[model samples]
Target: MTEDNIAKHGKKGTFQISCFYVGEALCGIDIGFVQEINKQVLLTSVPHSPDYVVGIMNLRGKIVTIIDLGKKLGIESTANITDDTRIIIVNSKQEFIGFLVNKVTDVVVADRENVSPAPSNIKGVKGKFFQGVYKYKNKLVAILDVEEVLENE
Candidate 1:
C-alpha cells in the first residue's frame, strides 16, 4: 500500500469492511461507503447503457443504477441471480449506485497495517480497481476502489 493510502485507510487505526463475492473472488468495500444491502430486486434495463450496467431499480422512490460488480471488474458476470445474490447500495457523489454481487459475505474489522498492495492481477481484475488487499482467516479480500470502479470506462 502507498503511504497515502495507508494514512487514509490505516491511520484511523482500523475500519470496518463489508465483504462479498464477485464470482469466486472475494472482495470488500469500506463500510462507511455502503448505504444498504438489498435482495435481488427487479431491474429495468437501460437501452444502450454500458454493458456493465445491469439496469436501474426504484429503491424506495429513489432511482439506483445497478452494475454487475464482476463485469465492472473484468471478472465473471453475476449472470445467474440466486437467492444469495445481493445489491450493495453505496452513495457516490450524492447519488446512490448499486453493485450486484454474487453474494454478501461477512463484515470484517481489519487493521490498516494488514492491508497489502494488490497484485498486478487478481482473478483477472486489474489492480487499479483495488485500494489494497486485506487478509482474514486465510482469505484475501480485494478492497475495491469505489471511485475507480464507478469511473466511466
Candidate 2:
C-alpha cells in the first residue's frame, strides 16, 4: 500500500452519538453533551426572538430555551404532538436548552473512518450544524452539533 492511502485510511476516531429522527431525517448528537430527555412538557413563547425559537420551558425549576428542531433544520413546524415527538434537554456552553424532535433512536458508536464529512453544498444553515455523516446499518445518519444549532438559532 502507498503512504498516501495509509495516511488517509489508517486511523479513525469514534464517539457515542445519540441518533434521533427530526421529521423524516435521521440525525445524531454527541451523548456526552446531552443531559436528559424530557417527555411532553409546557413551553412558554419568547417574544420577537426567531421563528425557530419555539419557546421556554421549566425543567426542575430551571428555565430552558426550547427550540423547534424541525424549524431549525428548515422543515415546517407543527403545534400538534405526535407519538414520535420528544424533548431532548442539553447543556451547551453551560447554557441549557431543549429541542423538539420526532423520535429517539439509539446510541451508536461512530468512527472517523466510517463517518464522511458533511456535504459542502446545502440549501440552508443546517450543514454547519452537522459534525459529519455516517451510515448505520444501511442508512445515512447525520451527527448534529447541538451547541451550534441552539447558539445559531
Candidate 3:
C-alpha cells in the first residue's frame, strides 16, 4: 500500500484496479482479472445470442465472446465506437471473455477498506453485478464481479 492510499483510506493491503467508463458511470475490476485491453476489434455477430453479447472475435488462435457491458448492466448501450472505446479481456473460471466499454480510463490502487457495499441500483446496473464500490479521486468506481457478470451465460 502506498503511503498516500494508506493515509487516505487508513487501511492496509492495497490492490490495483483497471478503471473504465460504461456510459457516464465509472467502473473497475481487479487488474489481476484482466488479460488484455484492445482499442477496437472486428466482431462477428452471433445469432440468437443474449442481448448483451455483442459478438465474437478471434484473438490469435482462440475465439473470444464479446459483451456489451453497459447493456448487460442495464446502464446504456455503447452507441458509437470512438477512440476511447475499449474491449477488456478477462479470464474467469478458465474461460476468456471480453467486456466492451465506453473507454479505458486509468489504473489505480485502492484500499479494500475503501470499498463499500453497492447500492440497490447504480447507473441502472443492479448491485448484484458488483463486488463493492470504491471512492477514487472524489469519484465513485463500482468494482465489478467478473464471476457474477459472466455467470448464467
Top-TM-score structure, candidate number: 1
- Once superposed on the true structure, which residue ranges of model 2 sit more than 4 Å away at CA? 1-12, 121-125
lDDT (CA) per prediction: 0.90, 0.75, 0.85
Query: If the candidates were sorted by their TM-score against the true structure, best first, what order would they fall in?
Result: 1, 3, 2
Winner on TM-score between 1 and 3 is 1
Better of 1 and 3 by lDDT: 1
lDDT for model 2: 0.75
What TM-score would every model get versus the actual structure? 0.95, 0.83, 0.89
Candidate 1 RMSD to the correct structure = 1.3
Give per-residue CA lDDT, model 2, range 88-107, as digits (tens).
Answer: 88888888888888788899
TM-score comparison, 2 vs 3, better candidate: 3
lDDT of 3: 0.85
RMSD of each: 1.3, 4.9, 5.1
The CA lDDT at 140 in model 2 is 80
Q: Which ten residues in a row have the lowest lDDT in candidate 2?
A: 1-10
Over the stretch 1-153, how does candidate 1's per-residue lDDT look in tens digits? 678888765474788999999999999999989999999569999999999999999988999999999888888898579999999999988999999999998999988777888898998889989999999999999999898888883
What's the residue-level lDDT of 138 in candidate 2? 94
Model 3 Cα lDDT, one tens digit per residue, 54-117: 8999998889999999888887887468888889999987888999999998998987866787
- Which sections of candidate 3 miss by over 4 Å? 1-12
